[model samples]
Target: MTDSGQFNSELMAFLDASPTPFHAVQSMQQRLQQAGFVRLDESQPWQLQPAGRYFTTRNGSSLIAFVRGTAALPEGGLRLIGAHTDSPCLMIKPHADLYAHGYHQLSVEVYGGALLNPWFDRDLSIAGRIVVSADGQLRSRLIDFKRPMAVIPSLAIHLDREANSDRTINPQNDIKPILLQGGDSSLQAIIAEQFMAADEQLVDYELSLYDCAGATLSGADSQFISSARLDNLLSCFVGLQSLLASDASHTAVLVCNDHEEVGSVSAVGADGPFLQAVLGRICGDQLDSALATSLLLSCDNAHALHPNFPAVHDAAHLPQLNGGPVIKTNVKQRYASNALGAALVKQLAGRCGVPLQSFVARNDMGCGSTIGPISAAKLGVNTLDIGIPQLAMHSARELTGASDPLRLVTLLTAFINSVAPLCVIAD
Candidate 1:
């Protein structure tokens, strides 16, 4: 296959492999480790040196990996790129058991800004964290109940005459997915048996409901990708591939955190101390300067204006498919990009002859945010938010530029390979 075809295959494989946030982090860890990156455990002391590759994970959902620069700790700082693993879905709630009209269902709370209507009548499955009893020991595992499992079917328009004109979902009542058709199909029992923890109590869970439908490449020429959870996972895959492929003298870092859709406040989220802790351990005492000159590219999917909804977007700055990576900005600071970060990316894109675009949400319309500001503040580093323009963000299936991921990987490779001097004294 050609390079583009190869990339498409790889991307589809990635999406298929990463069904949940936990799975995403695991896939990244495996890739980096295969590329010769040593795993670093924070519980143990870090003895970082130049020319080494190291990484660490948090709560099995967030990850931070960095390549040590050949030069000494730079007074400037590290080059960091960030993205998120989590997406909008329905999460199973604690005390999740429920039965209605002899139908078994799981209580669920909506996570993030989910387009609830699209989720209805879809082949939904359960995925995320689960604790098991293994040989009398409790262990946590991520599982995808990978089947045509549950669904929250919408009421027929004929039954609810005004369904099209006025319909709102009630997370507690209307959105509970129909899991089974019998007297307690023993959903919990099945989970316990699979986990080998039938004897143990179901202490807790953070499972999310996901569409089991596979992502596909459509169009006569296969120019379009349609799938769930593409809003940010596409960026995660691009960043991971770029970071692993990079052979730069300077350090290249990729951070994938969970909970980005729902305020990002979890322990494994960008708002948490995951990135900072990893960086601090890696840089040791020289972390001061290592953070000063550091820059981050917050990679997430940006909104592409839809022809049908042209009025919602800015008339002057319309982003098209395959246009290239977008440099996102918000006057209200929803995005963390500043003059310096924008200039640097643009200059680098120019130097590499790669096309670049810009995105600014209409002033009247509110904006969505990424992990950029959170990381910048946590590490005191400069950051820019960037992405490939996409349509159907947060929908059951999203669309993006066919060649955008490759373009982004190219620009990121350039950034990682570019050199900056570092001055330091070994402690």
Candidate 2:
């Protein structure tokens, strides 16, 4: 077992380094390479062997890492864990430069279902992938300013007496971050300067603004973690750690897809063919038989019961922070957890001695969804939705119990190494 403090310390480092999905995938790739996992290119032919560990990526944003076990594919099947790499934030637009009233700003569009209010009055930085033309060829590069470069200052109360009561943000005009009071540099020039490539021509880019603050332990007793993108990054880190600690006796796969926050419709998203294509190549002729015995655990942060908003949660199904991992369920299939899937997780948690909790939205309120339903539908695999409890899910900064992350990792590692049958026959 890993120390909770050590695990959290590393997780904080990961969060700080990964300001965007491209960065997150890059960070995970480094760790996977260090662990002796060979990288596979999708465009090339794969010569996979049993008991080999390998990883692959799509669009430099999503990643899939797997360990082929010594066991047969049709018998043990794949123990797959899924999470999303993308989060809600402000994305930089194509023509981002905006100069108004002697102030240079960058126009940004809201990405995903972000809580716009929290974005105001925050020190932000930009980081993402940029395509540049150099030496008569196009190349992609990842860049992070790694410092406070801009801010979205809120208007004072004097400007509007109802600023706090009836304030509404106009994504188009209100959220443009001020870059400098008076600057002659364009967005392209700034990016080129960062790369020290004055001769390179900027072709296209995908950039996003992120909070300058790093992840840290908070609360009176330091029981909570506060950071940006915890909605799904927390799950991504947990899944990665669990895969690293597995015994490798059974086939285990960890897939962190991009664009789940925006309905996952992209080519590299869970709704696409990324995972399916990889699985088909791995299972070959035994794909159908393997899927029949396979199980997927879709890990995403669950809404914790907020003290101030206790009435918003279902009375009996309220999940608490620091309690344990949550098994999310929705009768409408918003979540993919069924009785059989939930029972398997319960069994695994019980064997690992990890506490478990349940979460279901109040009858009147609508529930949020995760990659569970999407992956389950796409792969025809039994899937369960589970995660650590968190608060202020879509805010610029989110919170989760510091202890729950380690507990969730412990339970998932057990699932990955388990020799028990993954399937249960229904009467």
Candidate 3:
């Protein structure tokens, strides 16, 4: 119900607050709690009622929220939206502190297909979940350095004459980020300083380096948005906004999973049982019937046509920033959208008076995938892959059209709140 400008302002604030997946879900929980949503525990018996809005979390990274719609079960089934919270970044390795030539650095491994060179000469900080010894077992808490704590400086061009054109980065040798220059430096000691702990030891951690400059509107007319983790966090926030504003007739659900950037195979990933378990409990004996009519809107960011490299995308299917949301497709099933699902999306866009676009990677180029295929295969539900087009997908910072996010949220709100069932759509 909010205007686009107001929605975008809040979206940027959400991006700034969620530096890591753990922080992302926490922000989501806080927003949903403020919207009159109650928290549900996986270990407890769920007594969902009509008109109730509730949510649950796992591994402090993934989240699932649902609203019992005004309609009865089997009449409309579940309207689902899915996205991932994690993005490509460098994660600190165990015993990461390393000192050489009076400089202190931390050992890190690339989390996904990240652009290695852009990571250099940029401000970086650490954030993620930490486990400390509590009473007897371990307890977890999220932390953010929230300051420029590290950088991966490029080798001087003077040292290598062809450094500009002939650059080769070794992950093992060159990608280690410099934290500080000093002696007797310890990564654990730095992390311990952030903990409000007494008689507690840092046992386990999953921290990743992030850009601290945060999000802002860019471009000549300030029509572009630049930020870290926009690959899917943009979708997560858009889906959240849509769900909050939706007035659907059927049950509605929103899931923001972790580990999509890393193949979505972990306990909290889409490849696992998280969605299935929740759906099983929600529908109980009606699981089969509910799934037959359910639809999953797998939301993620699409690759926009880069002016410098337009051939990277299919000529006819090129998507543009600010155009609107895209219905992504792949002949390889890498993206799960089909004719039936596409029709449903187009119809909803028409009903909402929003423009729509499509994206297909160049035939010779390998296409990236989303959680769409995984969830469809797991639950036997029809799935549609859609997203707002953006540039610099795996870079520390990415860009998108300033208006596209709110536009997508408007379309999604229609999809989730639609009165008609999407079960047997005509092509």
Report residue 281 deviation for candidate 1 (angstroms): 1.6
Error of 1 at 361 (Å): 1.4
TM-score against truth, every candidate: 0.94, 0.99, 0.97
Residue 248 Cα positional deviation in candidate 1, in Å, after optimal superposition: 3.9
Candidate 2 regions exceeding 4 Å error are: none
Ranking by lDDT: 2, 3, 1
In candidate 2 the C-alpha lDDT for residue 419 amounts to: 96
Evaluate model 3: give its lDDT.
0.90
Candidate scoring better on lDDT of 1 and 3: 3
Candidate 2 versus truth, CA RMSD in Å, comes to 0.9
Better model by lDDT: candidate 2 vs candidate 3: 2
Tens-place lDDT per residue, model 1, 1-427, is: 1277788778877887777888888888888888899998888988877778888888888888888876555643577889999888788887777888888888888889988788889888888888756456777877887887788888888899988788887766788888887775666776776654445766567788888888788777777777778878888888887777666577778888888998888788888877777776767788887766778999998888798989998888888777889999887778999888888888889987779888888878898999988777777777899998889888877887677788888888778777642222236
Better of 1 and 2 by TM-score: 2
Error of 3 at 317 (Å): 1.1
* Model 1: residues with Cα > 4 Å off, grouped in runs: 134-136, 195-201, 420-427
Backbone clash count for every predicted candidate, in the order shown: 2, 0, 0
Top TM-score prediction, candidate number: 2
lDDT of 2 by residue, 146-245 (tens): 9999999988889889987898888998999999898777998888888747779999999999999999999999999999999888899999999988
